[model samples]
Target: MTTTPDDLAALLASVESDERDLVLSTFTHDDAWRLGCLLVELADERDLPVTIDVRKGPQQVFHAAREGTTPDNDSWVQRKVRVVERFGASSYLVGLRARAKGTTFADQHQLPLQEYAAHGGAFPVRVEGVGIVGVVTVSGLAQGDDHALVTEALRSFLGR
Candidate 1:
């Protein structure tokens, strides 16, 4: 399903406060590894060509299953992470809001496109009382699919 600004807003509202808070509480090297492995297994089962990354600040905690992905996917992950880190929201939500406003993140925020993307698949890892601490990202799927994949994985991981 194509995601609109409203849908993206709902997703952000659903995840940003509640889900992110809970998930970040469980954040750790082991949790990141498990989350990465789960994403890999999901992608493998679905025959998806994707790369998964989970990072805290500048430190990458876990990465898994780069299948049929190129260097471009890595770059996308970086860019999308930049968006999540900068905005403290999901990359797809940012993209949808920008589109709904008839603007692009690059043009609207005067940001470099090469360094920041507004596409999907990167979510802020926000703590309950602490705020954003990291990002979880996926690349090599359609924008909505990438967003959904990360969201679903977070839900499953958090047992929500």
Candidate 2:
């Protein structure tokens, strides 16, 4: 079903809450590995065709792709991750805010679609007080589904 404006409003609010509440006390390389693994496990359990990526700053900490995925998934992950890196927010939240203003994210921000995709899936990896130090991203499902999957993994990993 197509999302109504009220649905969009509620979704935007939920995503904002996820970004705010899903904070790590401190993120290490091990934390990235474990979190990334948890995401992959969740996808595998549901037999999802997707790719997962976790990055700390400019460095890739973990990555995985399910059997049905392709190189395009990698491209999409890169684009979504770029959005989180640039804006310090979940990609879906950015897209929703732009939509609420009756504009596309690329047009509103003057960002090229090729490099920065303000789509769902990429979420900022925020520390308790350090702010966004990395990103966790998933690609392959519908944009909103992709966002939800990542948030679900995060909430599980964080025991929230």
Candidate 3:
């Protein structure tokens, strides 16, 4: 689908709003597990083929792959996680910011494609005062769908 500048602006605003509003009081390994499970349930309910990953710092706390996912989905999750780790923003937000600046994410940041991806599906796990503690990522759908799935799960998990 073609994204008009207006659409991009609105999406960017929504992602920024999510980052600002979805702060957890605290995030723990248990919290990651709960969040990860929520994501899986949401995807499964919709019959989405996706791989989900939740990381606490450098340690992966939770992971799940739905039946239709391929190994490539895992790689996408990792790459999207790197984007969140490096930028402390949602992967979709990073990509939107790049587009807003009239550049591709890789070229704008000079990041290697194999190591980082500024695509949708990865979101920073932020605690109220602790900043970004980890990432929650999903892959296998269209990038925008992946992002929406994660955000929707976050909204549900956080009771937003």
Candidate 4:
């Protein structure tokens, strides 16, 4: 890595414009609110708390709240950032570990990493190779339900 201004500029230019837009556009969608609604519905039904946060490493750009007697998206995102920083690549592994049980996956008969998804909760809104640039988290619900809710919402937007 060089400190030259030209080097930095060249590195920045090396990044594909379309890739940047694809990642950027994924978050800017009006669907974040809709996804928030889905998380809320699941949370209310399960009597759990839900939070949708758009992250760029340790930084959060957008956060939507669904429940809790009080608003605490700020603290929650911080908590998530801490989780990511602490767990690194293993965070998602731990989240899959929190999974309920008897879930099927890559192997014919295998265990999930974390069913509850504690680091992010419920479903995953993360972008692969982006290192958790976004998250949808839930609490007060069973790990299974929590994972289902968040992942379902992710499926909706990620599907389209």
Candidate 5:
């Protein structure tokens, strides 16, 4: 089944009781949408320009933009996949992996461009009772803040 953007929010909105608990408990913290919102909020808080990409693959499941976001030749969807792939590869190339059994890879490394190009991103998504299923990636921000934005969003959205 295709997971539409509306599907995610509406599903989250209607969730309740043990059902909600089951869903929220599986995440290590940040989920994709929360991360996206955090990027926006951070952009506002810091007076920065950012474009957040939350994708499932080459396809962008969610894209959030703040004022003054630059349009790079590389679109958000492409960057999301690269971040996930680079992060995933660090495991084999460098013997790195998530400390937690199924939390995430230790965050992949990427070159930070001043304004364009994909910067910091994440690749770990929590699916409630389903456990970690995919990644929640964001680029076009400071590396640390980029990671924090995603993680913080996850924590806030999960209400945990």
Candidate 6:
């Protein structure tokens, strides 16, 4: 079924709290690598042509498996990451909220559309009480699919 804005909002509410509750005490490069590998493995099992990116602040620890993906997918990843970093929330959630408020992210936040994307597939890596530390992103699928894939991977990784 196609996800509506309300569905997206519900998803955001359900997952964001879990994400906050499941934060790592200390997120390391090894953690990023493992998470990235899990994302890639899951995507490959589904034969998805997606790029997986795991970043800690400005440092990208893992980026892999861009099968059937283009440079545009990389750009989408960066844009989605910008949205997550700016809002400290999942990119899809942000977009859904924007739509619910009857505005676009660029119009509502006055951010350049070229720089920030409110599309899916970018999730904040919240470090327990430390707040947002990084982002995990995937691209090259429908926006909701991208978000769902990352969310599912994170849930499995966090054992939530």
Give the runs in model 4 whose Cα sits over 4 Å from its true position. 1-38, 41-49, 67-77, 88-92, 95-125, 128-131
Best by lDDT: 2
lDDT of 2 by residue, 1-160 (tens): 7878898889888889988899989889999999999999999899999999999888999999999999999999999998888888999999999998888997899988889988899999999878998999999999989999999998998887
Against the hidden true structure, what lDDT does model 1 obtain? 0.81
Number of backbone collisions per candidate: 0, 0, 0, 16, 5, 0
Could you tell me every candidate's TM-score relative to the true structure? 0.85, 0.97, 0.97, 0.45, 0.50, 0.89
Alpha-carbon runs more than 4 Å astray in model 6: 1-9
Q: Candidate 6 on 13-101: residue-level lDDT in tens?
A: 86566456557677899999999999999998899999999998889999985579988888999999998887888898888777778
Report the C-alpha lDDT of model 3 over 49-150, residue by residue, as the tens digit.
Answer: 899999998999999999999998998998999899888899999999999888899889998899898989999998886899999999998888999998
Model 3 global lDDT (CA atoms, 0 to 1): 0.91
After the best TM-score superposition of candidate 4, give how far the Cα of residue 90 lies from its true spot, in angstroms. Answer: 8.0
* Candidate 1 regions with alpha-carbon error over 4 angstroms: 1-23
By summed lDDT, the worst window of 10 consecutive residues in model 4 runs over 15-24
- How many residue-pair clashes does candidate 3 contain? 0
| Candidates 1 and 4, the one with greater TM-score | 1
Of the candidates numbered 1 and 2, which has the greater lDDT value? 2
Clash pairs of candidate 1?
A: none
Q: Give the 10-residue window scoring lowest on summed lDDT in candidate 2.
A: 1-10
Query: Which sequence of candidate numbers ranks them by lDDT, best first?
Result: 2, 3, 6, 1, 5, 4
All candidates: CA RMSD (Å) = 2.7, 0.9, 0.9, 14.9, 13.3, 2.1
lDDT of 1 by residue, 55-105 (tens): 977799987656699889989999999988888778887876676677777
Candidate 5 Cα lDDT to native: 0.47
